[model samples]
Target: MEDVIVPIVLFSVLPVCIWLVSYFNYRKRLTAHETVRHAIDAGQTVSPELIEKMSLLVDPIRADLRRGVLFIAFGAAFAVLGMMVNFEDGDALMPMLGVASFPVFLGLAYLGLWAFGHGNKSA
Candidate 1:
């Protein structure tokens, strides 16, 4: 019972945490946009700097590179954890590698996007 429940809870929590993060970020962006919209409707002068500050935007290439590196680090951490858990004649590493592959591939995809976008930017 303990093993069954633990795995179920662990797997379930990941999606919930991801959803919560996404929801909060969406709400924050929505609030920022609404504030700008309200200010515009009130006949106030909206400056480009104000919009940029309110949006808290980062460069796309930089953001992608940062995310890619972060995800790769996460994958590496998981792989390390698996290595630490493995004992002589144990097959623990392969399962952990399977789990780590998701983040590794995702990081690679982000890196690819960054490279593609970086090449298209104007000097």
Candidate 2:
């Protein structure tokens, strides 16, 4: 029972965490964009300072994605290893967890790419 529960929790909780982190990052970026919009509406010039601040806002997402990608790669490797081991013992949970990690990482990667590609709204 404990063995199954531990693996289940590990499999489920991590994906949830990854998702929540990505969601919060996206929300934060939207909030920052709104702030910039407000600043522009107030007749503030689009100075270098403002641009620099906006660029800084993306650092967190990039860091998170980099970390997420690494975890996904590691999870994939572990999943393959687990599948190989389970051939004899016949458990599928760990391999499932391994497969699940890839999407989370891919999502995070896409988020990063989107942010970087569209970051400059005021060119």
In terms of TM-score, the best-performing candidate is 1
Candidate 2 clash pair list: none
Candidate 2 local lDDT, 1-123, one digit each (tens): 999999999889989987999899899889988888998999987888887878777765556556667766676776776677778878775766657677657756755764775565452
Task: Quantify all predictions' global Cα lDDT against the true fold.
Answer: 0.84, 0.74
Candidate 1 lDDT over 2-113, as tens digits, reads 9899999999999998999779767877888888889999999999999767644535677789889989999999898888878653799999988888899999999998
RMSD of 2: 6.8
Which regions of candidate 2 fall more than 4 Å away from where they truly are?
Answer: 1-4, 60-123
Error of 1 at 100 (Å): 1.7
Best by lDDT: 1
The lDDT of model 2 is 0.74
**Deviation in angstroms for 58 in model 2?**
0.5
RMSD each, Å? 3.2, 6.8
Assess the local accuracy of residue 32 in candidate 1 as a C-alpha lDDT between 0 and 100. 84
**How well does candidate 2 match the true structure in TM-score terms?**
0.46
